[model samples]
Target chain A: MESLVLKDISITLGQNLVFDKLSLEFNKKVNTSIIGPGGSGKTTICKILNGDLKYNGSILINGIEIGESNNYLLEKYVGVVLNNSYNKNSLVIDELFAGLDTCNLDYEEEEKRVKKVVKYFKLQDILEKRISSFTIQKKYYIKIIKELIRGCAYIVLDDIFINMDLKEVKRIISYCKQENITIINITSEMEYVLETDNLVVLYNKNVAMVGSTIECLKEEKLLRRLGFNLPFLVDLSIQLGYYGLINKVIIDDRKMIDAIWK
Target chain B: MEIILQDIVCNSTKADKCLNKVNYTFKENSINFCSGLSGRLLRDLLTLKKQRESGYIFVNPNGRLSDIGYVGNNPLKEFTCKTVAEQMLYFKDNYHLKYNNVQEKIKSALLMVGLDESYLSRVITSLSTSELKKVSLACVLFYNPQVLIVDYFEKGLNYKDIEYFKKLFKKLKIKYNRNIIICSDNISNYLDILDEYVIFNNGVLEVKGTNKELYNNVIYKYIEEPHIIKFINLVRKKKGVELDNYIDIKELIKAIYRDVENK
Candidate 1:
């Protein structure tokens, strides 16, 4: 299986050392979420993974340093969906096909991949509409679709879902999982943490905690100390677990109800 | 002052109706949340930033354009000046408000928003996201508008910041008599603080309800129910246990403890 590894990475912005010798590993097809408070270098990590920032250590994907990876291979293996500003006058169709030629895929394969994602997202209705006409949430969806059309193996989502509706966010996440894309979501919102397979908590420019989502979440005190708003159910479960109202930390509302009433 | 939108219609850039003949009233000195399809359009109309295609909007008690204060998602983008003092002074100059002690008034405004006088000299860009948001609120409170619209209440905020803003909004409504309208599609964030919810679906007013009224209302059909509320409803439906509509997790936990112990 393809895996992404960050070995002893360090990034400094001017006088401040945002990250110092930070190390982490993420495997393919395992959706990992990195969460931290504001100014904790979450977005900086995204920039490093996308090869947009100059850092000290190497970022290896599939045992090869990302810096040495060919343009086509890099584009195919990694994609980033940041809330970056884009040209509003461009049409959705143009935005989708803007970087199609750069991908290693041939003409027919590229068109097929683009068509599949467009159809899945039901973008046929607004393909001709200017990006300026769509809402901020819709624009994010379009950006995600643009990345998905490239058939990216590892997609790093940089806090693009905070402003979106939760239901729609879950739907898109499930679709990405079906396509077996390794999702590295960096967010301040803890509610989306429950949807990921693994969790990475950043504090003081380093990894404070990292484990399976549920195992990492069980340490409520550390996460709280790290300045995260625990997901509602998680918080309630921990509270109830303390009171012996429920046996275990139940993340789902229905299961918690059953555990309580049983 | 109450904000009443009467047959208010807003069109998009393509001339399509974004807010279709919307009629709603945001009561004075209360906390209100507007969500759904045309929520942003409604925000623009309330601020008079976007001209309506048809109908009228009435801000009662002779409220003018300056009476409406809007703070969007990113408050840093709203700043034209560099320092906190300059932004406050710019508002004073732009509104032509004459004050006997302008410096003292600026300090007081900063304090009111939970910021100290030290922030006055700090550059706006140097402040953190939450600090910038508070500075933005301070700048808005300088004018002391009746209707204060905040877009995306819990986006960048942490748990403590969210709790802080909740108290601040309550203080704004109760002590200051300002109407707080938070424009966010996420209903979960406002469970503890929201007084009323006005949801729009497909460019039309879908439903308007108070706190308890939305516990089992049509709002859930469009938007997902908040986790606490969903659990409460599940207990009521599945186990035939009627738990109080407790917005606080602690209170709900206490109630559950009482019920489980009594059994």
Candidate 2:
């Protein structure tokens, strides 16, 4: 699999070392979550990926150099979906569909594509509603649709799920999974990281742990020492594993429930 | 400080009345929350945007209007100063306090929000969203306000930042006897930290009780519960595995272990 890879990246922001020889890789199609506490350089990493911040290392997406790619073209493949404020004045549907080509397809074809993207996020019911009128929870979903329409494969969301509860975010996870979109959720919330395929934990400006979500969370004491608690399901699954009720730490609720049933 | 809103009738431009004969008495030195209400209604309560039809909001008798501090909902817009230290001094001036300890208070305020003295010199516009929020919180707490209102206070904050705020607010209530009232739709995030929840239904005071008291109430019916709570409820409903008194992840894990052990 072609992967988004960072090689020996280092960054210093105004005397603070944000990253020090930090290296990580993400497959192009798998969901990854980067989580850490405040001042842990989650946003800084996002800026570097989004080409807003300069760093002294190599960032390659499927072996294409990130620094050399044109801004407009670079964004299409490795775009970001920032947590746009709910009170933004621009109409969202118009904004999402603004930059596409108009050379060949007629209005109906474009509208059909828009409708498909809208249906992907289940926004068919409220596609015409004003962006300002949406509840705060739904606003992030709109950004996801916008990013998909903008053709961003490696989507970086730093704080989009800050206000979203776990249940709401899980639905978004399913959507991303079905679309095979590579999501890098950069935040301190364990909710997203627990649901994602890969987990990257940051602490003291370095990668503390990197593994599959279930495996990394199995470092329960280490995570707790870093001032974070595991997700309820992960913790429970670990405890059940200790009791020999389950053979391994399972991330799925249905699997764990069925295991317990057996 | 205590806030008593009695028989309050508030009308929206589109609707006849959003708040209908609502009544609530927010007590002193408590961590209070109001959920299931529009952010507009909650903002109006915290800000007093419009006049009530035939009711009154009674603040503590000796309370100066300046003592009531609001932290969010365009904190920068309400700010008059361009820098951090000056913001605290402005609050000092507005409160008509003696200027002798203004700098000291500014330092203490910044420290309260986990910012150091160096942050006082930084330009407000250069601060991050989390930093701005902490700065706003510091400015409000700098005045030693008896009653503090946090409107969607956890906005733009990470989980650890929220924990710091929870600890600080609890300290403020216990040590200084200050009232920390949060008006947020994200109730589950603050569920563990809140001492009491004041739920609103159709702008009326639907229920008011401690966290345990309000947990099983129908008010949580509308909004989603926190994941652990929902998980426990689901397990109980589906597998007949009833866990007892889960406040957080650790407790829930223990409860599950005990259940599985007994089996």
Candidate 3:
């Protein structure tokens, strides 16, 4: 029942104020997505979560202050895979096991973890392939696998799904959910938000909206005003609602067609 | 300008060649979208940034090579200068363009890309990813080419920026009568604006057709169909209602409304 909480967070880069006195909470074991316009501080929040940037307020992971916690504690609680590129020369196997080398796990335990993750993801074939040889989707898969092996409770995906198809992204997210890992996805792609359990909308350097994924999406007007276009189905349902055809956001094609006909 | 490729074999050294004997034509003043993992390679080859392993590319209206402007995916890496003005100056010098007023030329190019004179002195390293992309695009616009090539519209760009670029590209195509070729892995990004679709998979040309043509063709087997297409298809198959294939959300909404009202 651990939760990731932020309180009175304020940060600025150079002359621009990115986030101002922002506060939010990510319920553990819940897959959450953060979305906003460009320069709206989505990446800044990811950096704060990973302890990569200096900020004014407190970030609490399972009631431990992130600022005071050591790297060991932070690593145990959170794992981050930013959208930035990985070293092209590194092999997949080496990338997967590099984090575990710091975990103090026994050699046998490390192998067991690596083997389980590789088998789970069906990544056994690409273990020897260099990162450069793999496609964008495969590279992200390797990064997620590496984090899975390290055994972090919460994994932050920073808009890495832009290049990946919706089906592929859903498969990976569903698998992570099955593994009982909290997935916090920071993204600009509104389509990916439909897959997460919770949704956080940031706008003008503050939290604009936060609620269950579908509920937040139902506020189509606010989403648009904040410089975000709702996903196709959601937008369709909203328009249909205006015409007195459908009542709620219908993401599935069959269900939506059924609603219109019914 | 029209670009025709004959038996194009690119990136031959790689296990999966980016293009395998691909024969395609990018029509004049048309929007072409090359979608797949090897899209970057295809774009590089089209822009002459990289040499093809083996191929015969025929660009109609000779001297089209100088007329093709390319904006790559990673804009930060596309620059070598310290500031925006310096970069623009270097491009002007490198291209050896005869600009009567260098300052006026720089200002106009930046303005075209939605930036202004204030951005000229800004350091390239300090600019945001979106700004860098704008600057990269400005560098290309400085040349005022007849054909424009842009790569990866979605990566590092937000919804607003993508929409802006989409509108800008459409203006360049329609108003200016310029040919545009966009290379992206996700076809959904340019589904509405694109006139033709050239899909590649593992360095092989899977299919090439107009948006409407490919919607009913076997293109679905290679790439994920847009949600609007999927919805339209479902309505056609299950409910026996034929809806026009509309990529734009607003148009699709209206079509759905009309269909529901008729029902």
Candidate 4:
């Protein structure tokens, strides 16, 4: 079943028409990353998904058209972490669970969930610390993945990788995959996006490309024109193929190393 | 223009020192990149401060001269000028530098950083991520300091903008003899432009050397071992081609094509 569906979506911000007839469907248990340039409406799409921004076209969740009736319902299902920094003074890590007390989930049950995610993110050392003292990047580290682990049906992250290290990014991606959380990560970094199950390329506020990872990588000219960096592994694989060193282009470094050794 | 740090240590509010007696000297009139993991305290060491420590940072140029600049991550917060033009002029007026035309200077700075001239009149709050970054860079460029300390150099720039900024840095160094100290987690992105690198791990200065030497060094085995470097190494081993240190894909392609042509 499709977890989220955006059909012929169009968004206009101020004098700019950000998205033009863009359409895409995200399936449950599949991690999807949206790749685009800086101002290519990737954030607009995420806003539409989170119901923060209104669009002209249709967005359906579980075959139910998204509108007033389902807006609040959708909030329970979708967890979002935007690109901007978050400032949460007078709040601590334990207080986060206390605030979620009104969400109807039992305190003990919520603690287990929070503890599980906190440990996963290696936040055990700073669990009692105030949110105000944490760095902008650390605030994101706790907020983004923790909310998703607390039973949000869909996860949406925008440019979270910009402030993150490679190990943290890899851990977050791996956690999203292990949890079977339907993730829609929007990033300008192609290397980070290539780790996703599917890729959506937005150019000039339109859906220029959409397909598997390799399919998007194969369209090097289009990717270049969109100002997206090609993944180094993909470039290496292509170079090897160009030099007749390898017959098949492999994106996984381990697989490529195995092929070369063989 | 060389910035030499000897026994530099910065402590946070809780008495936890982010930088622990770190020491290194960045080459003059050249790009020096510092890369490490996020939350690894690289930025703190670069700026010589923690989260709470915000005031003036002293940039020692060689042994005899030193200059001070306001130290803050968000440049927009540091500016109090009412208009964009006023802001550029304010920096010039206070610094006592004369430009041919204030408007032209602002326009050139915006264009050099890949921003449209139409944004000059717009409020600073109205700018996009990339635009805001360009404006910050413009402020730095306008100051034309002997030494520039940049944090997250390519944070919000697209691929084209990254290339543009790379070329802009080279031009700035050549034309104006400006020295840049860029702090980022991704070093390969600026390998072509950088003359030296200073690796910071856990607030301690681990290694400082040329780009090639750092690449060959085993301490940075993971971060510096980019695929391009591996591919270049592979070509050198397989075909005995002496590739340049800054061997990007385009350069690799040209080298391969040349080899084929000669054969």
The candidate with the higher DockQ, 1 or 2, is: 1
Q: Write the per-residue lDDT of candidate 3 for residues A197-227, one digit (tens) a residue.
A: 8999888899999999999988877787777
lDDT of 2 by residue, A1-262 (tens): 7788888889987656878989889897778888776667777777787778888888877887666645454566776766435465556677456534522466786677677777665666665566666556666767666666555567788677766755657767766677677888876667567657899988887899998888888899888777776776677777777767777776666666667755
Give the Å shift of residue A45 in candidate 3.
1.5
Q: What is the lDDT of every predicted structure here?
A: 0.80, 0.73, 0.80, 0.68
Q: Over the stretch B82-194, how does candidate 4's per-residue lDDT look in tens digits?
A: 55667777778777776777777778766776776776666775455666677777765665666666666576567887888888888878887877777666776787888
Q: CA shift at A18, candidate 1, in angstroms?
A: 2.5
Model 4 / residue A24 / CA error / Å? 2.8
lDDT computed for candidate 1: 0.80
- Candidate 3, clashing residue pairs? none
- Candidates 2 and 3 compared: the better one by DockQ is 3
Clash counts for all predictions: 0, 0, 0, 0
Which pairs of residues have clashing backbones in candidate 1? none
Lowest summed lDDT across 10 adjacent residues in model 1 chain B is found at B9-18
Docking class of 1: acceptable
**In CAPRI terms, where does candidate 3 land?**
medium
Better structure of 1 and 3 per DockQ: 3
Score candidate 3 by DockQ. Answer: 0.55
Which candidate achieves the best TM-score against the true structure? Answer: 3
Cα lDDT of model 1 by residue, B81-153, tens digit:
9899999899888888778999888888888777889888888765656677888888988888888888775
